[model samples]
Target chain A: MSSDVLVSVRGLEVHFPVRGEGIRKKGAGVLRAVDGVDLDILRGETLGLVGESGCGKSTLGNAVLRLIPSTGGSVHFAGTDVTSVGGKGLRELRRRAGMVFQDPFASLDPRRTVAQTVSEPLEVHGLRSGRRERAARVGELLELVGLDPAVAGRYPHEFSGGQRQRVGIARALAGEPDFLVCDEAIASLDVSVQAQVLNLLRRLQKQLGLTLLFISHDLSAVRHISDRIAVMYLGRIVEIGPASAVGSDPQMPYTQALLSAVPLPHPALERERKRIVLRGDVPSPSAVPSGCRFRTRCPYVFEPCDDVDPALQPAGAAGQQAACHLHGVVGTPVERTPEGVTAEP
Target chain B: MGARSGAPRGSEPASAVTAGTAPVLEVEDLRVRLRTPRGPADVVNGLSYTVGPGETVAVVGESGSGKSVSVLALLGLLPARVATVTGRAVLQGEDLLTMKPERLRQVRGPGAGMVFQDPMTSLNPVLTVGRQLVEGIRAHGDVSKEAARSRAADLLGEVGLPDPKGALDRYPHELSGGMRQRVVIAIALSNSPALLIADEATTALDVTVQAQIIDLIENLQADRGTGVIWITHDLGVVAGIADRVLVMYGGRCVEDGTVDDVLERPAHPYTRGLLGALPDLARPAVDGVVPDLATVPGTPPAPTDLPEGCVFWPRCPVRGDARCEHEQPPLVQIQGLDRHFGPSGLPHRAATWCTEPTSDTGLPASGTGSTALGGDR
Candidate 1:
């Protein structure tokens, strides 16, 4: 691992067991939300994770932050294995990392004031020993997110959607953490309000020298904020590369189709662009296809894709890697997933 | 006009030339006042638009912008007590706003169909997909149960559902989000309705599924010449699907024009701001560096507390004129446009003070917010 790597994850798995009918024993079915994934977030670099629902991008993000327990593998943060930490070590880890959720409406407590929400993080970390100092810090954090400090006494319902999201950011940044994970942070906001929040986040990241793991299903929104992009399929990363390369010339067929499916706002360009529409819906994670998880919907499916799962290998572009057998090195034997039925359309 | 004459014609789509005349639905000075806890709020204030046969008119706006409410009013779906809808909604020849309850009910399914964002909103959880589709079909015609069942299967096939025969036996919960949406679309189209009002129908689906649904709707509309009202906040979907676009802000039609005219050469500052906010995939970043995203500061005003002046005056980046603060702007025709999407030839219009040479926006004549946004992304 490089010295600049702030957080590293290896072979992470988050499988959820399914139950039959009303109350049967743990069924044979296991939903592999994040199946054996490897990822790394470099210091001061924004890593964008993109995928559709049920693709495990959110689970991978939550696991890296240690917000949820992982089934297997490891997550290393600042030279420590976060997955194994407990008690004081975990509390210290929480102080060092923060997260911003997708829905501001649900994430915030309706009863709490903005100051209380922001100051609670400060109190939990035992920072700013006095109440006055904590209040000042809360005011500063609110201003940093472009909200008025005077409004800190108001409840979330008193503010607009954009303002409430700013309060959420203030609470997240109250920890003064070096790393932040924004999981669809701006997805719930309006198009105009989304830009304001995006700008605030970019400015904050640069100002504080914070590394961000920006995860979103909206491809267009994530493309601008991310330095590097990672595309996730059923439960695994299929492609990872610079944002420009991934947006323009994606190596994996799934990424190509995903990018193509996003309709551009430009009328002339939208009409002229060639769309590579896939055949069917994404297969259920419980019954994932054998070999390449994306092969079931991949237009460039070949013989090796039927049984041999391709590993991420160096692509033609610099610092780019893809898991498709078509672009990467062949003959490397990887574990094969069980055979499964096709998706129901 | 009654249901028969006002209804859109057969499967053959009308040509571009015939679209300007004989509009299927014409809404004139449409207004809706909802009795809220605070007070009576004017949600839709004199909003107007016309949808011709085979044309898809997109009503684009964010939440609380009254895009959805206006359509509900036109269809007489709003409750009488909670909402006071006063508008001239002429469908074919009959006035929907003045029609009796029985007449309005008759105009709902066979005359106009509806698709919502959540497929479950339109589907019955306990009933099978086939049963719901059959019920909707049988309600309009004198068809037998077996005939309606066959038609329901055919509708499912048309919406691209796999194994249409087997799907008839499955409940709504048995299908995926995309499949359930397809089933809903099948039910909506079962009666061969002349009009379809889809309110964020594909917003919940994934992009791949959204693309499929968009294509399906476009194909169905073209073959059947169904007039469509697509209510959404996503501009990308509008650019791809809409023949004409009506932009709503604070329950008013802020901008109205053909898709090419409105999207490519937006005249209103609100429309320009909306375009600047969205990250355009086609707009390549200069040298490897992405420009800072443009933003319109502050949020839309609440319906109850809307400004007496221009609806967007509070958040308008190009509030160049002094009159903008004290007076409301009318929907004026935009002048000196270089090109037009001639098919609709529907004159581009905007309800703003800054779309003209007289306003002198003090920015670029292009008015695309290129400089304000530190070079558009």
Candidate 2:
């Protein structure tokens, strides 16, 4: 366990047991939602875990926090192996790692006031000295997320989508956790409000010096906020690199395709740029392809791609890593060009 | 095939009917106030814009900016008991606001059609996609059921749905989000309405699906000469489709111009902020944080509780003194460009007393010779 790493996940796998109704009597099959994966988040940096829906990004985040028990692998946070932690130890681990859910409306207890909702974490962690101290702390937390402390008395329903997200942020920060996992936090927000909340998160991350794992399908938002980005496909990291390098000069065909699909705000650029429309939908996690997970939809798939699963290897001008057969060719640096970087023909 | 071969020039008819000049849909001074228990609360106040035939006009604003409300009012879709609406929604010289219910119903499917956000909710779960599409066609036209069904399948095929016949049999729930949206589009185009109002129609779908839908709409509009009113908050969607852009804030038209004019050389402060705030993929990343993303602080003013003078003054980053606070800014013709604050006649132009020179602020040089945006009154 590295002390420098805030959260280190090693070959993490989460599988749900599915029972067969007619044919099979015993355990029928395992739904491999999260296949073997390894990732690490250093102190005070945002590690973006990005994938399409049902790619198990959320499941990975949940499993790491020990909200859901993993079928295999270890999650170590702050020099503690949390995979086997139970009861008090698990509670302590949870205190050091908090989760910010996707839907602010659904995640929050509607009946509870803002103060109560945020303070619940403090109470659960047994950090508060008294009711008065907890109240004050709640006020501070509210202020930290750019919400008025006076609004702490109000219910969640009274606030807008952006404000409710602020309250959710306040609650997540209540434990003063070293690591925070924001799972699609800004997905539900309006574009303008999304910007505000993202800026607020950036400010808070710097101020608190907190490590974060920001999970989202929004490539633009993820590229904006993440220091390092990990592109997930079928419960595997297909590419991992610095945000700028991955965004500007993507080596992976999948990453290039993903980036090209993002609509540019400017009319000139939007009309000018070529869009790569990937054929077919995202495959189900349970029945992933045998070799390369992305082989089913990858534009550059060759004969060898179906047979050999390429591990994530270094590519690009910078030391960006991508898992693709093209990059797997021996002693050949995948040259980056403006046309080559684009997914569209 | 005959219709395709002998079809009138797509762009000529709309331009010709109104002397090759008039807009397909011209909304002027539209106001919608809901009759609440307390009083009439103005949801959409004084909104105006035009959509040229075969051209797309986007109403860009945040959630409660009255973009949706104004369109709803135009369509006569709002429940009369709840909403008291006043405005001139003229479509090809016919005032929609004053039309009787029977006439409005006749106009609805054939004259104009609407595609709403959330295709899942908008579509009927119990009915097959075919049934719904045929129903829309039969409602407005004296067509046989078989003819409508074939037309429905053809429409679905036109929108790029695979195995249109099979898809038609499937209920809304059985289809993917993208497929369902296509079905909705098929229904919207069933009557072959001259105008299509899509209110956040593609917002619910993923980026790839959204691109497909936008392409479908653009293709259909080009082929059919259908005028489209695209209401959305996403600048990206607007950039892709709209020929003209209308920037709405607080139920008012702050800026209206060609896509290039509004997107590249945004004049209004609110417009500038919105453009600035959008995370530009082309821009170089700064310290892992995207730069030039400036957020307009404070929430949108509630319709029932709008501020005096400029409704945007409270949140406007460039707001100046008492004039902005006391005197309501009217949209005026600054140079040749007409800028109106509210939804009245194009004549009632409003430039803030504290207008700043266009050169210093990166605004387009005014042809109307109005004072700078931030100049003192």
Candidate 3:
């Protein structure tokens, strides 16, 4: 309910119905993609959401933006309840918020030119008057994203993967949205080009004071662009904190395992570091394990982990919280003081 | 052990594969020209390198850099009708380039096994996992169906698959992405090939799963002394698994050296740019300071229309002069600060290229040089 909070999500859930098995029952079961989750995005800051595939990171992002219908809970954006809005109100909500998808090729219309694609948002919201003014705005949007306005005539196929992504960004910014949800925006790009797009997003955020939600599986990239980090696991936020604290001193066991899984670019560090490789692949959402969803794969699972699912609590660090039963355990290492300052390891 | 007993060993003859001596696979001046409508486009131009026994040489490059194409050409994977590959590729003292189709087919499975990028596409959808693995094993060996099936189950167990026997009956779709990749690896190692060509093998998998697969490959390589060619764009994976690194740009080996030398003190501008572009997880994030990721400006040149001089000159931040535009720089040994010049009378090595921006230019040296990197380390 803070004034500075751009998007506030509370117990957001997105569940899909499992289709019929063979010729039997049509609605066999429910696949809880994004089971109860809560998060907040502050104005003008990039909150990175990271998790492996099937972890519901993308589902949560989509639900927040109202692109996907949520099964339960609510998403409030800029003082308006996003989940309840409809018709004009929903269109207005969309105008104030936009989403940039992962695959540039699939997200963009192949037949449309850069200008046509970008100008659609303006036309949808009735932002600018006349064809000429919308065209001018499209030019500005392209320029803002570091693409030459001259390329406006070019089709999506003509531009490279990175350039196509830039066009997507331009389209997203066409409505002049205050909040941007980039779902794995740079995941499909090359490393060098990923850097370019990441820098561009940061620059645009600063220039426009835009609140951004960057959802990606690339931990290094999430660390680079995000001011705050949120780690999702099996449709829930397990750890949330300042990027620095969460990345370096992760409180949750899952976060620790995820960070350790990342291969450092430095050979010496890579060779020296010992990684905690998790045991198995993520369990199917339809048949999620009882109690904590991560209990099946948790390396340090204890008795309580399988009995009581932990909730996010202050991890004794500034703006840091983790959902873990072993937080107070003697040998768990991540103990917090009364003031919420984490004890140094 | 029936599969292993009857089949030719994936490793070369003991005399041919002496560790640390001669390389198991030596590719010299390898060129791959694809027959497009416009003309013959040289996808892989004059590439050369070697994979030593029990050694892992990581080939790093962005998409369309010919890292995969060059290796495919070397292995005769490219269709003969579409690609004209000319090179001297000697595998265990035998010329692979000129070898007959029949001989190459015989060498492919037991001699050299390949694991491709997408595990889903690499596997047969209709075929059960056990059937595929068994078929792959029997392809290179004269073994009974039951023996092959047993060997396939053993291979599955070796890859750390849970309920290995149960997984054998499941189809590709029944497995997770990570499990599919493990199945691919198991098939690749069915005959214990001496040379393993993994082309972005784990790129499609999640980081956690990627780590497990990498460990599996490392353990297998350690046991069998298999020479591995890991083609990937991910620098982090290259740093983790490779003994030596080959940074490819525009179908050429831009830089080649030990992992420490290439990664820590990257000589080539492209390599430096690649390293710089990667967001370092090791570096702590600082508040109020926006760390601008250093990026290489232009896209890689098209194969048909490459630059007249250095392929990288167009995007090189420290490109020297008109000479760089006219002549290609050769790879010169860079042990010391002593400059080694090519026939064009200009320093050709990346080490020399690194020094050119600082030593000669009166302008304060930009941050891509070895001096800036040394401070970073």
- List of clashing residue pairs for candidate 3: A316-A340, A316-A341, A316-A342
Report the C-alpha displacement of residue A259, candidate 1, in angstroms: 0.4
Give the winner by TM-score: 1
Which candidate ranks first by DockQ, i.e. highest? 3
Ranking by TM-score: 1, 3, 2
Off by over 4 Å in 2: A17-31, A329-345, B1-21, B286-289, B336-377
Model 1: pairs clashing at backbone N, Cα or C within 3 Å: B1-B93, B1-B94
- After superposing candidate 1 on the true structure, give the runs of residues whose Cα lies further than 4 Å from its correct spot: A21-26, A331-345, B1-21, B337-345, B356-377
Q: Where does the lowest 10-residue lDDT sum fall in candidate 3 chain A? A: A336-345
Q: Which structure among the candidates has the greatest lDDT?
A: 1
Interface DockQ per candidate = 0.44, 0.37, 0.51
Model 3 lDDT per residue over A182-227, tens place: 9999999999999999999999999999999999999999998999
What CAPRI-style quality would you assign to candidate 2? acceptable
Better of 1 and 2 by lDDT: 1
Model 3 earns a TM-score of 0.91
Candidate 3 docking band: medium
